[model samples]
Target: MAESRSETLRVAWHGGDRFEIQIRGHSVRVDEPKDFGGSDTGPTATELFVGSLAACVADCAERYLHRCQLPAGVTVTARYDLGLQPARLSKVALDVEAPGLPEGLRESFTAVIRHCPVHNTLFRAPEVTFHVLTSGHEAVCHHP
Candidate 1:
């Protein structure tokens, strides 16, 4: 049997081009840079996207190394480029730095990153749809 879980996040406009994001019990801010008429208080959507990918890969790499009995620190940095014409992601470049990685574990670490959730997700893109509520009934929230 396979098991799965759901993830949900909420965001509300915070005046100007800033938004308040709620994930679990934490609050984060998302906004555009000052040159784009924003307060530049936090990372923009593009930054979050690339940042998530790096974080995901780093986490998986670290876990895989430790499981091999060679625990080491991992750092991942991703650079993104904007595609023209339609304005989409053109390319993503990632640098994985593991200063303490064992000599024989390079191949295994590379393989582990290949299966990183975020990296795999990019390999097989998921469906993304937009919905707008022109008119709808008031919804109630219930929490425990």
Candidate 2:
């Protein structure tokens, strides 16, 4: 039998291009166009995407180090290349810096990065499904 996976995140939009994101039942506010936004102030959507990738990797690294009972400190800096003609995410580069860690632990941490969910998901190009409901009508869109 396969192991079960379950988690839920909810997002609701407030007035004026502001949104509330609920992750595992906790609420966070996010907005766009910094000049007239809340919570994150003025972080663009694309910036947030890159931030998520870095955060995901860092989270996994931290967990792996803790599990191995190794003292490690990791910091990741991610840069995105968005200079394509059609305006798509061209490349993502990450700089991982670890200080005060055992020698072998660094190699093990590198392995953990390969298995990080965000890294795996990005490489797989998983399908996305969108649902729209308006005026008692519903529409679904699937991308493969």
Candidate 3:
């Protein structure tokens, strides 16, 4: 780890539609439900997005609380409303509960959530560029 560094994450298939994700020093697994051709071994893609937002906010709040010398008790529950017409994510609501926090710092906590990178990014349309690579079958893999 170093100051002002850029990092890249990697994700590869483990087995049976379950993916192995390498991030920082952690290995995460993402899988589909049994009905969707998976054994329900891990969280699905939709769950991952909800979980990421919750976890990111919690991480930000935790740092702020630590700086304020507050006791550690932070919880974030994320709920999503799916739209059927386009099979899209309609809305995501987060219920943050911090029992050990002081009332005086409540405003700052709201600001922290507003300023959280993940939170802000979710509201904006991302510029996603797709790149396709072609090979001559020289390097073939069973993995997707």
Candidate 4:
């Protein structure tokens, strides 16, 4: 059997329906509906997805601004509208505010936005597969 390129995350129930996720040396506590086997505290999975998107965009914007020799005070604000029923993401908007930037820097920044990994991934649909692992089981799969 071959090892998988993807990473494995371990999750354990802390108490009162809250779960602790161990990934990349970080521990994240997550909970959900009180009756749905989770605590009423913390954001839901869908909300977390949007949160990840926002964080990725912010990181990209900050890195781009730093690489472009911009000032130290650059900020990005992002918001999203989620659709009901199907629970799909409807729209995502971003506002960039930077001080001490040259006159035509907005265009350069917009160009960088097009290359953001999260934005690109959201726009493109990639194949996704799920595997259930037991106590000492391993699953290997390839992604094209």
TM-score to true structure, per model: 0.86, 0.74, 0.80, 0.70
lDDT of 2 by residue, 1-144 (tens): 178586778878876667777897777666776454544554556777788889889888888878877666879999889866778778999987766567867787888887787788888987788766688766556876
Best by lDDT: 1
lDDT of 1 by residue, 17-105 (tens): 99999999999899999999999999998898889889989999888878876758888888889898877889999999988887887
lDDT of all the models against the reference? 0.87, 0.77, 0.84, 0.73
Candidate achieving the largest TM-score: 1
Candidate 3 lowest-lDDT run of ten: 132-141
Candidate 4's residue-wise lDDT over 26-135, tens digit each?
A: 98777888777777777666667777776776677677778977775656676888788877988878776767567787787777766676677887966889667777
lDDT ranking from best to worst?
Answer: 1, 3, 2, 4
List the RMSD of every prediction in angstroms: 6.7, 4.4, 4.6, 6.9
Any idea what lDDT model 1 has?
0.87
Model 1 clash number:
0
Q: Candidate 2 at residue 70, lDDT?
A: 66
Q: Model 2 RMSD to the real structure?
A: 4.4
Order of quality (TM-score): 1, 3, 2, 4
